[model samples]
Target: MSEENKQIAQELIDAVGGLENISSVAHCATRLRIMVKDKEKIDQNRAEDIDKVKGAYYNAGQYQVIFGTGTVNRIYEQFIALGAPESTKSEQKEETKKQGNKFQQIIRTFGDIFVPIIPVLVATGLFMGLRGLVTQEEILALFGTSPDALSDNFMLYTQVLTDTAFAFLPALVAWSAFRVFGGSPVIGIVLGLMLVNPELPNAYAVGEGEADPLMFLGFIPVVGYQGSVLPAFIAGFLGAKLEKWLRQRVAESLDLILTPFLTLLIMITGALLVIGPIFSAVEAAIMAGTTFVLQLPFGLSGLLVGGLHQVIVITGVHHIFNLFEIQLLADDGMNPFNALITAGIAAQGGAALAVALKTRSKKLKALAFPSSISAFLGITEPAIFGVNLRYIKPFAMALIGGAAGGFFAALFNLEASGMAITVIPGSLLYVYDFVPLMLYVITNVIALGTAFVLTWMFGFSDKMLEEVKTE
Candidate 1:
């Protein structure tokens, strides 16, 4: 740790109370989550008073301190230096261990891992989804006559910005996972790109067949690492741990030479042999589980669809589900679950739109409007956090409303024939398959209308709604 960082960390620890008072310390994307045995053991107000500290919150049995951007490592080192005992000293472990059930743990872990990245994920994902909307028809029209239309510059830029992420999702996840695990995000990104490189054909399975190949250590096969979660996460987690350990152990004299070499050796080997397979298995398990749930009685499916849809959005793993929708659409030429999620996304938007129209705060309104539009396009965090979560009531109302929509869609067995950006008229691509097209349209329209009415009724108050237009 830098002397300056060490100083800051030490001072903050001292201010909070000696390391002995700290029951546990952990971190998420941008904050130091600390738990002290006693509320009075250390001065909470004093910790918050520090210049480097952004803010603090005591909730769900955790004391969270927001810190400077990218300061987690420094803070972590300082906590260690303060001679705080490891997990053995933690008082809350018993309570934390009892957190409901496996489903809840999965939900909690998913939230812990992905919530911090939602803003960026949604921004980039939305932009890509929108870009597709802008270029799809033109590309299709051009392709209708000439195959070369896709080669145009306008199409190329859009393709690069939007399709590139899917094409290189493994790399994006690697970086995001690295950030999550306290590693150099740049290194994680480079490692991710290597996994997906087309020239490295054998390196990973390119969506389609490729001629050239890249071998890992000249042997183990690297497969689709893009947009994958488990492999990158496993690799990045090991890499970060290795890096931290090496940086601490290597002598200053030979550190430069030994550190990078050992780190790379550990990461590459660990990723190729372990992380990759683990993630693949996880992917398989999830698909199996979802398939099982979908096959259940319609009410059960509706419940899972409604509840898990939001959970999926929260975890940023909905893209994997979206991929399933796309494949199902292509194979069966229709997908009912997709309709369920569409309703869920619409519910998010309805709730946010309600809050936007009812909130008195100008800043909140400004924040809510764009988010609501984004949710309409199928990105929901800005709506979820900025609006729905704040009002609290709206999210639950939306969820129940979403369940109602899902029940109706499932009862009708409405399926989208193809996936399209939600904002585009092209989202109507599968509407023709609707039995009694008018009923299908009305059903979907009612889904959104019901959500809106529910949110308005459940979320709006005379005072809040009246204060809304003040600005």
Candidate 2:
């Protein structure tokens, strides 16, 4: 490692309050995820204030500090240099289980697990969308008049890659969460796999009308904990605690065989019997609350599509909406969330594009442009972080544009036939749906274009661009 890199990493560790303060640490493709014992100890606002720090968030039980691509590696090297091991720590012997503030803990745990996995999820989602284009019969039929004979290879390939992520994602999250809580990753992975595996469908009663499949052990009362953002987190938290408790009682010599076996037995059982019900109730309540909000008198659909979508984007829990969309499609023949996401993407992209054109700083313009373009294509993370997020004006512009778009969609009583991107080419499959294909295309284009125009007219400042670029 370069001495300079080591020095920077050490400084980061020190700034965050030494290696001991860390419960667990990991990195995504771009950010460093640090789970600390106490959020109060770290100056989150100060970290964000640093010119070098791109963004910082405290969510789902984890404290996240974002750095551009290469920063995580540098931080990791420094962590090693400071004699702090990269692997998770052994489970701490004693934890007070009196259950503190339940809501806050759940949020923190959710953040720790989900924020790091977002890049992979987005990549896979985009890939799945592309694969649909390659395999759709009508698309291929357009090329060669034989609709029925269109090849399934593209669809198959996409399905396999996409399913691999979805099928095993619980395991992936569990591994990350366990590490966050400072426990054995292997055991956590096993627990996650158990939750998502289809063959052993765990059953959960989600009220009177719905019987949601738990998809793990039948013992859990919560439904569809598989691929669930919260349950995996709760499982990891409980799993880590259970593992630690077992580790203390077993003799050192028999630890190797007994520790894992006993931990698995206890954690899995505990998860199914206790943790699942509690988490399921919480999930049910949140969904119920959101649904209730959508029933409000003040154009509930527009408010939800515009306001809640923004909140989810910031917390990075927006991915949860994908599952909800799929569920709605399967159950209700329509999905409001899908429409909202499409509109949100258009709004965000438009705002970024507007800012890009108005900014005189060549570097800021360069960064903002590509990020905005990608946002139009339905991947908004880059734009959200690199462009619109910090620019107060752009985000507001996007939200207003999004609200306008979503309100139009709801007014027309539009419904997507399937999950598809809002872009012109991607909306081809929804051509025959309740909302005409032409309207869908025009709505997104207008929303995005209007946002860009408004951003330029009201929010543009070359000085602001220069300040951001120089910093």
Candidate 3:
């Protein structure tokens, strides 16, 4: 290990009351999460003062210290070299259940289930964006073909790339939910398949009055669930629960065969008759509510959501937005949330840059500069947790910038073709439409410029950069 890393490891061990007092140690994307045997024995202020440690807090029964991203991984390596037992993030989360509140647990649960699926969604979004670009009249003119002619020959290929994920989205949700809930993943995926079985009428076709639903008992209307989120999520949850219950009662000798048979039969019945129908309606209601909020006149809703999003990022519950974005994309194939939220993110980066530029202290500059770049890359943890939030005024300036940008986005009806990215990389989402690309650029530039100018003017001062001498 390097001399600097070794020293950091020793200081961290001491900050948490020595190695013996630590129950476990793990690092997430940005924080070093450490479980302690006794909370009183640790020194939070000292932990925060550790070199490269931006801030520290106790949440969900773990002392989480912000070390940014790459830096945290290196420091974690040092902790292992110092004899701290390597533990999984799942292990830390399991222990958190004992102390985390019901609300926190629910939010964390959603986060866990949704985070794993982002890569697929991001890829799908890119496909859709590309399709939009190629179909544009301006682009197609260069190829000596029109959108209609291209659609006749190449639309099926586009559908395979872009539509396949949403066509059977339920299966993916169920498969992921099952794995997270500790049930059989194969069983969960199979159950999801049944929801979108080819035998039943398509959900979209029925919604458009083009196909009739299958009437079970001649009273309850039933149809296939395609591109649905809640139905699949709840089905996975219930399937896992029912499977576990069956396992407990089924005899050891017949367990394998009987458990699978009983679980499938019962889950299918419950999904079609009860859970599926109820949750789909609930999901529709939620989608409508979200649309209403985002559509509120003058971008008031965007202002509120954009201004507060980073604050919630600190608590790590921002992953909940993944569900909402997915549902929105399935509805209209457009994601206003993606466009609206970027303003706050860009503003945070701007505020951090302002601090980096204005600070005379080399150490402070060193920390804030890279954090600003990280924020620009769409992960704001380093900028928000490391620098902006540490100084109250910069965070406040970022909020104003975020709010202004969000308001403009809403006013102009700016939206993205996909979800799960923002800032620099997010430019890909607006590729299909010239207007969106232009509007997206203006919104974020306004946010960044507003924050940078405001912060450089008054939000930050040179006096705050003074370094403390140590023995």
Per TM-score, the best of the predicted structures is: 3
lDDT of 3 by residue, 372-436 (tens): 99889998877876778767789999999998888888898998888889999999999987899
| Model 3: lDDT of residue 8 | 88
Model 1: per-residue Cα lDDT over 138-202, one tens digit each: 54565574334446887777656545545565566667666756677777777777666555444
Candidate 2 off by > 4 Å: 1-108, 116-137, 143-173, 195-230, 291-299, 311-339, 356-395, 409-443, 461-471
Q: Report the C-alpha displacement of residue 296, candidate 2, in angstroms.
A: 7.7
| Residue 411, candidate 1: alpha-carbon lDDT | 66
Selected candidate, larger lDDT, 1 vs 3:
3
Which regions of candidate 3 are displaced past 4 Å?
40-42, 68-70, 465-471
Query: Over the stretch 82-195, how does candidate 2's per-residue lDDT look in tens digits?
Result: 776454312221121112366544544555555666556545545544555555566666687453564587446667865565556668777887887878999999988777
Model 1, poorest ten-residue lDDT window? 417-426
Q: Of 2 and 3, which scores higher on lDDT?
A: 3
Best by lDDT: 3
**TM-score for all predictions?**
0.52, 0.60, 0.95
